[model samples]
Target chain A: MAVLERSYKRYAGALSPEWSRFLIIPRHAFRDVFRSKLFTGLYALSFMAPLVFAILIYLRHNTEALAIMKLSVVNVLPIDATFFLTFVEIQGWVGFFLALLVGPQQVARDLTNNGLPLYLCRPFSRSEYVVGKMSIVILLLSSITWVPGLILFGLQSYLEGWSWFSQNIPIASAIFLGSLVWILLLALLTQTISAWVKWRLAASAGLIGLFFIPSVFAAILNQMLATRWGNLLSLGSLIRSVWAGLFGTFVQQAGQVQRMRGGVIVETAMVEPPLWASWLILFLICALCLWLLSRKVKAYEVVK
Target chain B: MTLDAPATSSHLNDSPGVITLDNLSVTFGGRPILKSLNGDLRGRAIGLLGPNGAGKTTLIHTLLGFHQPSAGTARILGSDIRGEANQIKSLIGYMPERDSFISKMSCIHFVRFMAELSGLPPGAALERAHEALFFVGLGEARYRNVDTFSLGMKQLAKLAQAIVHGPRLIFLDEPTNGLDPPARSRMIKMIREIRDSGQANIVLSSHLLRDVEECCEEIVILKDGRLVVYCNLEEERKANKKFLMLETRGDLKSFVEGIGSLGCECAMTSDHRLKIILQDGTEIRDLYKLAAASQVQIRRLTYKRDSLEDIFLKAMENGSN
Candidate 1:
């Protein structure tokens, strides 16, 4: 019998460069995130802080509006280092919640369904898969955190003029670097937890517990050991320390941190760990998450 | 069923098979799965026939660079499996036995995603995804979510993603699994079309002999992790001595004598069933004329050739010995 002629033709076009292949994972991930109305709402809400901060910068610089409102800059909100610090801190925390919403479902579903083989069977390696999944969280967190934080910083600099911008250049740098560190930590931690825990809800809960559970244990250690070294276990304390260090406000903000926790106004005996220790601890944690991710993401699981 | 001599050559460098194994062995926790398997297969559509636990999937995985060999190595398309894994994967497509798709995606989206992962540009990937879905008979439901597809549809979607990149070699592990008769027939037809297109070489692994028999040009039968038979179906058919079965309602002794005189081997296993091996000069027409002359009624006549099942059963028997 004569063979049936197929209309299908081979693809003769050039492939995209190899480096751009990993972008496919994040591209689809962004689409999936935006597909959900709730995720879209949360993502939009994350920009609110930067938007409000931008408006505040505008109001502080516009003397006519301030005069119309009959409010002085000091009487309203003083736009200074602490103001931008608070801005970045708020944005970073919002990024954390965003990670909790989207991170657990990113790689967990793929791992649970044994879909790594599909990815690895192509031209992609295991490291590419990990970086691809990480990009989803990195892009999500970046949109709300450093990206807008820097935009607001630019707005503040534009409104306040070059003299003020030059004097406070370090503050802008702090906002960018501080928010970047926060998002990186959150992205790695959430992705690692998600990769290990197959269920989305359990992985989400595990990510939350990873941040909070250590603080409780750290508190017990602090009470027993009479040292602030235990605070190293608390992600909140470590991040705050890192943030303060980035802004060069740790010495001035330590008392406020203690007071905000409702501790007595007297001098506390617990000496906070050095800033280097905080940075070291965060780096180690990031490394550990990467190791765990590498262990879990593979084409096939060999069972002995 | 006659068994051919075992493939005793360590490696066949003279003939470059589509895939070559040189003492390839794999183990899990010191327990061997595939033990020093060596063969060269050049069939356009090769069938991997094995029972459960016969290491069919493992062999496919090894060839795809999923499993690192414990001892020797394998080369696919002149590229070593270990070092050139990404290079090899870029040129090949794989459809695993189990459910291995991202279900949350639409069929076209998933196929496009897979094609992009195989290194096609996004635009070309999208176009090829549509073409592959239509080729696999899933164009109508291309917009449907993959998770919502029926078992047969899901299988076709798997096939679509596998071929979306226009790969040079495609590995299909149980491609017709879990389908009804019509779906199975459609799958076999698709496989035949793919084979006929000359666009890619297909390695179809199946436990069902009919599926392999219908689509494969050559076969490799494995039993207990050993290569029991590696023979081309075309050669096997040509090598077969023609046999004929006759059911007559008259004296069989005279019929056997008549057939023997015609230079054919004749045997009578029962009163009414006669088996005859035809010689080169003898034909069925001559037998009918002989039967008419001998006053015998020819009720049935069947011509037989060697089948994949016969080779598989013979390979199993030889492996046990």
Candidate 2:
């Protein structure tokens, strides 16, 4: 019917495919997410790390610029596994902050304003709803995390030649797969917190507390119990272990000297937790978050 | 605009009813909210009526696939709610009793989002969203955030979203709740127009008997999770006809006897008032002729029937039995 008629009319038009309907959630959610100037600024700021990394990679290959500065190749930071690992770590934190800002409000607003019935009453399932909300964080995080990291990897591969690229193929995989693990973990955790805590500020705080509070407790447990097993409580430590394992630098990073005493270097030789254990812990944490999300994301509560 | 188009699909099977409950039951924590509700509701506009705590909303929720049926299942538009819930959801729209809307979203945008979720393409969803907002008399305010709307406007926005996708069936729970008279009338008028448009079937659940009486062709009343009564209002109204109340000036006793002799049941409520149930083929002119013969001045004569309130009360009493 014409808009001027101002009456109910049957829409006999073609419908979108059923599988693509869930995309509508993220489409609208992205509109709301980008509306925040603070978030937009932070998101734009997230690309600075990759841009700096890209320039550094370019400088490594640019001998003329280096000669003009009268600096040798060894004087600058080496673009090794450590370099890419540090880049992944920095982007991971950026992803975390963005998730904290965007993820908490994804499901909380719907729950707080009684909007789930409007969604769940349509041709949308709870699983689809969760996936849609999770995609908001996933897409935003992916753009900053793996997407730019891969572009940087490709740039280095093109500049450094096939010999270095062939020798360090795992770094490329580590950049993509490691970033994915972190992004998925952050997305799931924030969404689970959003589903449980209907208040946005509380959900954001809950996400921060989930990461920081446990690390503090883990530190205390490690000091008192003298066991590295306590590190399992710390998500940050687990993720670092997993990332180090992914980059094949676990041995080098884990055996660093702790201190120097009495004019002599004191090497602690601290053995890191097994890589499998860290993977298991992260998987279990993600699983628990999924369970909590499934339990809380519903159209109505049954009060008995 | 005049609505003359036939419904695009006749997929709603009449024999199975628009909504068919097959021993449907729902329980929360061990207590049953809907206890084996079994019936087929087939009407252009079906009214679900009950007092508070009567499982009206629970039944709707069950049919919408929000609550799992503890015993049996229901079907909407020939699809099993359990097996084809998403398909059924695509065909149906729900306006919940309580306030439900996305905050900080414009009215048109909210409706458009809902339509998109129902599988409408973006452009069509937006177009329909605007038409729906305008149809609900929120055309001027479509761009305003939903959180800023008054209760009445919010109700209209809820309706706009519910109908934006051109659903085959619509479930409206408390559609006129907490509205002033004019807004309530407007809402009722919209409901009637939608029902008459024949583009969608309507299932209206409300406690107000007048609202149901005004809009519903058939009613299903529940009490204490039990089916209290299911009757066609049109048939009930027809059957309740030929009943009248009268006030007369003289010879009430003879007038009563004369009314009985003419095959009408008459009762004297007071010295000057009478309640008469006219038999079939009985005419009011016959009563007037009898009243003149009896020298009784028929001062005030009024037609009376069992109203929806009376029907509801009788159902309540019978349901208690």
Estimate every model's Cα lDDT from 0 to 1. Answer: 0.85, 0.88
| DockQ of model 2 vs. true complex | 0.63
Interface root mean square deviation per prediction: 4.8, 1.3
Output per-candidate TM-scores for chain A, rounded to 2 decimals: 0.90, 0.92
Residue B257 of model 2: what lDDT? 82
lDDT of 1 at B215: 95
Model 1, A42-155: lDDT tens digits are 988888888888878888888898899998877667788888889888988888888999898888888876788899888899888888888888888888887887788788
Tens-digit lDDT track of model 2 for B175-241: 9999999999999999999999998899999999989999999899899998878888877787766
| Residue pairs in clash, model 1 | none
Q: Return the lDDT, model 1, position B98.
A: 87
How big is the positional error of residue B309 in model 2, measured in Å on the Cα after superposition? 1.0
CAPRI accuracy category, model 2: medium
For candidate 1, give the lDDT of residue A294. 85
Model 2: CA > 4 A from native: A256-269, B1-14, B242-301
